[model samples]
Target: MIDALTVALGVTALLLAAWCGFAAYRDQPTKDWHFIGMAVVALLAVVQLVIGVVRLAGGDDPQQGVAIFVAYLIGSALAVPIAAFMSLTERTRWGSATVSAAAVVLAVLEVRLYDIWGGVGG
Candidate 1:
């Protein structure tokens, strides 16, 4: 993984997590901005996944981290959209809160991604 791009994705993840956390605590509706943020994060994740696969094909060792990293990637990619749709079904603050929780998951996955590459990341 490219260090700088991973850093950028991580920063985005952090912001998303904070926003989601606040939304959950306040029992607020999930905002469009939240969806937008998730979409952007997803887009970045797609790029990261591509890079990862390319590196793997190029013989960049995963150092035993590949399985978890790939799993995290799939989880991170699915979380936002799936949660958003599920949240919409309930129309309650708790439904929205599910989305917030998903955001946190996505953010945490980014950290895992960094560590998977054996970077001095957290």
Candidate 2:
């Protein structure tokens, strides 16, 4: 697993979380800008997913079990999109809250992904 890429994803997720949280605190609904942030995070997640799959296919086994690792990869990749869709259902501060929650969740998942990869330099 690439530690740098993992760290990048985590940091981006956290930033997005902070943005959404600020919007929510201001009682603003989710905006196009927020969706753009989600798209960026989702793109990074997709890249990470592809890299993980290729690495695994090339016989680089994760220290953790394959099922768990792959599960994290897929879940991380889908999280932002799922949250965005849910946000679309509400047009209030709650929508921003949903996105903020999703971003935080993605960050947590990234950390777990790192652990599942057996940590940096593993």
TM-score of each: 0.80, 0.96
Q: How close to the true structure is residue 64 of candidate 1, measured as C-alpha lDDT?
A: 47
Best by TM-score: 2
Worst 10 residues of 1 by lDDT: 113-122
List of clashing residue pairs for candidate 1: none
What does candidate 1's lDDT look like per residue over 1-122, in tens digits?
36566778778867776776687788777777777877887788778777777877787766447777677667766777788788677666776678767777777777777777777532
| Candidate 2 per-residue lDDT over residues 8-107, each given as its tens digit | 9999999999999999999999999999999999999999999998888988878888899999999999999999999899889999999999999999
Query: Model 2 lDDT vs. the true structure?
Result: 0.92
Model 2 stretches with alpha carbons more than 4 Å out:
none
Best by lDDT: 2
The models' CA-based lDDT, in order, is 0.73, 0.92
Error of 2 at 104 (Å): 0.6
